[model samples]
Target: MRTLHIITGLGIGGAEQQLRLMLRHLPTSSSVVTLTNPGPVARGIEADGVPVIHLGMAGNRDLGALPRLTRLVRQGRYDLVHTHLYRACLYGRIAARLAGVRPVIATEHSLGDAQIEGRPLTSGARALYLAGERLGTSTVAVSPSVARRLEEWGVRRSRIHVVPNGIEVARFAFDPAARRAAREQLGLAPDAFVVGGVGRLAVGKRFDRLVRAVAALPDARLLLVGEGDQREELLRTAGECGAADRVLLSGRCEDPPPAGAAPDTLTLPSLLAAMDVFVSTSPDEAFGLAVVEALAAGLPVLYVACPAVDDLPPGSAPGARRIGPSVPELTAALREVRRAGGARLPQPAAVRRYDIAAGARQLMSLYENAVHGTPLPHEVSCS
Candidate 1:
C-alpha cells in the first residue's frame, strides 16, 4: 500500500533515524515529507531510494504551508498518512483530513512526564497535542512508559498502541576491528577506558552529569555522539572540571551507513564499538533507545531512567543497570566498571526484543488496520 510519512524535520535524532531504519524493512510503497529542515537523515533516506519532499515550512505559524501540504497529499492519493514528532502531527493530520484521507496515524516518539521533545511540557502544548491527537485514527507510543503517559493525559486506552522503538541489532554487534578503527580515528589509545553516551547534547539529556562524572576519572575518555545547542556548554563544563582534553563530541553520527560508505566513516555502531561502557544520564526518558543499542553491542549499560529496560521483565537485559542521577553516583559507577575491565557482555535478550524488522511488521499491521477500518488493537506488553 502507498503510505506518506510526515515528520517535523529529518535531523539526526532518534525518531528521524528510526524512520529511515523502519522504511528499510517495511514492505510497502512509501515516501517522506519533512515540514522543515531536510538535514542529514533526509539525505540518508533518499540514498535508501525513497523519495523525500521538503515542504519548506517556514515556521509553526506559517499557515500558508497547510494548503501546499493538503495539495500534495491529494495529489499523492496515499492510502494512509503516518506522522511523527509534534509539528508534523499537528499539520499532517489536518492536511490528511482536508485531502479526504481518513487513515492517519501518529507516533508519540518523545513524551516525558515533565518534558516533550526536550522542551518543558507546558499546559498549552498538552492541550494542542490532545486536540491534534483526536484527528488521527490511532496513536502509537514508542514504549509502555509513553503509553502510560498518554493514558494519564486522558487519551482513551483503546486509541493507544504500544510499539517500542527498535534498532538494527546485528549492525550493532560488537566488532574488535571496528573498535580499533574507531578508537584510532578518535585518537583514543587501545587500552584507554572510554565512556560513551549517544543523544542530543541537550539539558534534558543531562549530559553535563556524564561529563562531570567522566571528568572525575583522569583516564576515562568521553565520546559523545549527536549535536545540539548545548555543545558549548558541555565543553565549558569539561573545561571547568579540567576534563576538556578527554571529552570528544562527535557530532551527529548516523548508523547503518549508506552502501559503499567510506571505510573510515564514523557511524553510531562503530562509536559504540570503541566504547568501554555506555551511560544514559537523562533522569527522564521516553524509551531509552540508545540503551538498547548499547545492549546490542554487548556493552554494559548504566542508566538513570529507561522505560525500555524498566518496563521489561527482569533478566531481560542483564548487562543494563539503573543508577542514581547524581554526578557522584555516576562517577562511582564508572570507577567500579573501570576496575572490572572492558569486557563485552553476552548479547542480551533486550536486543532481540526490539529488533527493527519486528517493529516494522507491527507498524504494517497498524497501517492495514487503519486502512481497512479494522478496530485498532489495545495496548500490549512489550515482553
Candidate 2:
C-alpha cells in the first residue's frame, strides 16, 4: 500500500528526526508530503529517492491551501496518511479524509500545553484536533505524557497509541577513538570536562538555566548546539552568566563529530561521545530525543524530572540522573556527574527501548491496524 507521510517543515528537530526514521524503514513506495516549504530534511528524503510534494502553505490556517492538498492525496491514490506536529496533523488528516484514504494517522510530538509565540490556537485548535482524531483511524503519541494530555483534552483513550520515539542504536554506538578525535578537532583540552546540550535555543528549553549551571562549575566547558529564534537572547544570557568564552555555541551541526582526533561537525553520535556528561534543562519536553541519543552513546544524562524524562527506562543507564526542577539542583547534579566520573558510559543494549528500528516496526503495526480495522493487541488504554 502506498503511504503518504506529512509534516510541517523539514527543519532538524525531534518530530522531523522521527519522521525520517519512519520513512527510511518503511517500504520503498511510501511518499512524503510537506504542507509548508521543505527545509534540510527534504534533501535527506530526496537523497533516499522518495517522492516529496510541497503544498506551499504560507500560514498555519491556510484554508485555500487545503483543497489543493486534498486533491494531491486523492490523485496520488495513497492508502494511508501519517502526519506529525500541529499544523500538519490538522490539515493533513482532514485532507486525507477528503481524499478517502483508508487510515489517517497522526503522531503527537508536542506537550499540547505550551503556547507557540506568534501562533495562538489553544481551545479551538484542541477541539479541532479532537474532532479530526475521532474521524481518523488511529493516533500515535511519542511519549506517555503526551498521550495523557490528549486524553485530558477529550480524545478517546481507545484510539490513541503510545509509541515512544526511537533512535538508531548502532549509529549512536560508543566510539572511543571518535571521542578523542572530536575533542582534538574542537580544540578542547584533554583534561577539560565537556558538558553538551542540544536543542533549539528557546525559553521553554531553559538553555539559560544550563548556562547558569555551567558558569557555577569551574574548569567545565559547555557545548550548545542547534539554531532557533532565541539564539541572540540565549547568547546574551550566556554573556550575563560569564560563560561566553567557556561555552561553545556550535550552531546547526549536521555531521557528527569527526573520528580520530579531527574537529568535524558534531554528528549526534559524535557529540554524545565527546561529552563527559549530557544535560537537558528543558522544562517541558514531550520526549527527550537528545537525552536518548546521549544514552545510546553510553553517556550519562542529567535531565530535569519533567513528564518527558519519566519515559526513560529506569536503571537502563548509570548516567541517567534526575534532578529537581531548580537551577541549584541542576547545578549540583552537573557537578556531581562530573565528580562521579560520568557513571561509566552506558552500553547500547541499555537503550534498545528507544531504538529507531524497533519504533519503526511498532509504527508499521499501527498503520496496519489502522488500515485493517483491527485493534492493536497490546494497545495502551489512554484513560
Error of 1 at 253 (Å): 0.4
List model 1 lDDT by residue over 1-383, tens digit each: 99999999998889999999999999989999999999888999999999999999999999999999999999998999999999999999999999999999999999998999888998899999999999998899999899999999878888888888999888889999999999999999999999999999888899999999999999899999989999999999999999999999999787667667887898888899999999999998899999999999999999999999999999999999999999999999999999988479988988899998888878887988889855444433221
Task: Give the range of the ten consecutive residues with the poorest summed lDDT in model 1.
Answer: 374-383
lDDT of 2 by residue, 1-383 (tens): 78888888876666775677667777537888888868777766776677778888989867998999899899888878888887888888889888888588888887545643224448787787787777677788888887877788888888788888877678887888788878887878877889899988777788888887888887889988888888888778778888888888878754322123234556777766778888888766677778878877888788874444575466555557777768798788888777778344656444776777777767777877777765555634341
Which residue pairs overlap in candidate 2's backbone?
167-356, 181-261, 185-263, 255-267, 256-266, 256-267, 257-267
| Candidate 1 to truth, TM | 0.97
TM-score of each: 0.97, 0.91
> What is residue 346's positional error in candidate 1, in angstroms?
1.0
